[model samples]
Target: MTWTAPEPTRVGEPLTGPERPMLQGWLDWHRRTLLTKCAGLTADQLKLAAVEPSNLTLLGLVRHMTDVERVWFRWRAAGDHTVGSPYNSADNPDGDFDDVATADAEADLARFEAACADADRAAATLDLDHEFATARGRRSLRWVYLHMIEEYARHNGHADLLRERIDGVTGA
Candidate 1:
């Protein structure tokens, strides 16, 4: 399925498609926005822990957001299809990045990218007005897409700081 969005990027710009405030437009914009937040960084820079007390690394955020996208869209929205086990286990809410070894960096990133791809594909085909029930109760796919946009937009702000602190680069 193809993306039906009208925007080129999620934030600070108009897009190159048929003009409309469609669901795909918002979701695609947000998707691009989230991915852009992670652009222009080395694997090491992405793993920076500059603030010590802060777990505010770009890589950490990627892993966490990937888990979030998976749970909300794939697991909950898709009605319990397996996309691997939940990243958050009984004793590990941060399991997404809990074992961030230098050796595993590539694999972890691949996982995140794959998750995003899966989400894009699902969203392209899934109905925006469809309802999905979860522990939080049923929600429209409209809610899910907007929620994802909110989730990534918020974290991308944090990513700007982490990236800037790492290398002084910033922007949407």
Candidate 2:
């Protein structure tokens, strides 16, 4: 039997809430939205870069978002320098997107889920205004939250197109 990516239950972002919860809710919604786009796809289907010459695939989006979660939440926001890139390196910076042909789809999705959980924990105790220094200057937890949402939204768009091309399924 071929293995397919499991569907995720995505919650609707709260209509009205406090600042932190609102931001977190929207971020989580976007995260789940990405996974939803990959639901019910076999590993081979996910590995297909339906758009030629782009090298963009559903699995690659998952891998890229996994790294994004780790970098923004754990490394940057939580100030945990020990948390290194899980799927990329200076020698192969684009490994997450470029190296998915032979990748294990199930394991990669699991890793993305784990990264999201870790990211939540890392920022759990952080105040939205908490600031951290970066190579580009400084950023706050609020900024990270917003940036992550934007990141997921952009990638989820790609995921939507990829998934639709893989199969006729559509609707977010």
Candidate 3:
């Protein structure tokens, strides 16, 4: 039997909380928003491209975001150089989005969830002020949270369109 992506359990973003909790909550909400967009779609549907000349698909977005989480949190923020991105490389820079047609949607979704979990774990011990070097110079854990939130927000919008395109389902 083919694996199926499960519906995400989305929680309301905490309107009142500490700096860390609020950031984490908002990030989690956005993450779930992405998964929720993909939920209830079949593997073939998940792989359907938005239109001609565009490789953007729900599965591709999931795969791309999984690597984004791993890269920022596990690698850069936590300073773990050994942990490499699951998708993308020098030869296949667009693997995350370009290589989704034959990809396993369920496995990719699980990978996204696992990456998020690992990101949370990697960030748990760090202070918001903790800094890490990147190609754009040094940045802080606080910046990582804000950046991830922004990244997800942008992609979630694309996901919303992709989901609606796939089936007439709409609404957040």
Candidate 4:
């Protein structure tokens, strides 16, 4: 049997809830939104850029967001300073985007899922006001959550455009 990517299950963001649940709901919604945009795409299709001279792609976005989730949630927000991003280095800072032409879309998606799960575990015990040290100084867990939501929301837009360019599919 041929292997195919499973369809993404998108859950709507809560219109009314407590702050934590609401924030998490929105973040999860945006995360799934990105994957939904990539549904039914092949590996090459996942690597298709929106335009010339740009490294942006749905797979790249997924890998990049995986890095983002690991960095912010596990390392920064949870105060686990030992972890480092796999997609970045001094000499290869754009590895997530630049290296994605050869990315394994299914494995990349699994990496994203693991990152999100780790992020949730890391943040489970912390209150919204919990503080952690970063290069820019102290920041609250709330800030991290908000920043991640913004990150996914922004990248999901790029994913939308890439998806549309790939097959003319639109409307989230």
Give the local distance difference test score of model 4.
Answer: 0.86
Residue 10 displacement (Å), model 4: 1.6
What is the descending TM-score order? 2, 3, 4, 1
Tens-digit lDDT track of model 1 for 1-172: 3212122234544456642245456656665665565665556666677556886676777778778778777877776577654356778767666645452445656677788788767765677777887776889778887787788778778877776787776776
**Could you tell which candidate, 1 or 3, scores higher by lDDT?**
3
lDDT of 2: 0.91
Candidate whose TM-score is highest = 2
Please provide, for model 4 over 1-172, each residue's C-alpha lDDT reduced to its tens digit, 9 standing for 90 to 100: 4335568888888999799999899988988888888788887888888766676888889889999999898888887888787677889998988898767788888888888888999989899999988778999999999999999888888888888888999978
lDDT of 3 at 29: 97
Which portions of model 4 show Cα errors greater than 4 Å? 1-3
Q: Which pairs clash in the backbone of model 1?
A: 7-15, 8-15
Backbone clash count, each prediction separately: 2, 0, 0, 0
Write the residue-wise lDDT of candidate 3 on 1-172 in tens digits. Answer: 6555688899998999799999999999999999999888889989999755777999999999999999999899999989876778999999999998788888889899999999999999899999988887999999999999999999999999998888977777
Models ranked on lDDT = 2, 3, 4, 1
Q: Model 1: runs farther than 4 Å from truth?
A: 1-21, 85-87
Give me the runs in candidate 2 sitting further than 4 Å from their true place: none
Worst 10 residues of 2 by lDDT: 78-87
Candidate 2 TM-score versus the reference: 0.98
Q: Is candidate 1 or candidate 3 better by TM-score?
A: 3
| Candidate lDDT (C-alpha), each | 0.67, 0.91, 0.91, 0.86
Instruction: Locate the minimum summed-lDDT window of 10 residues in model 3.
Output: 1-10
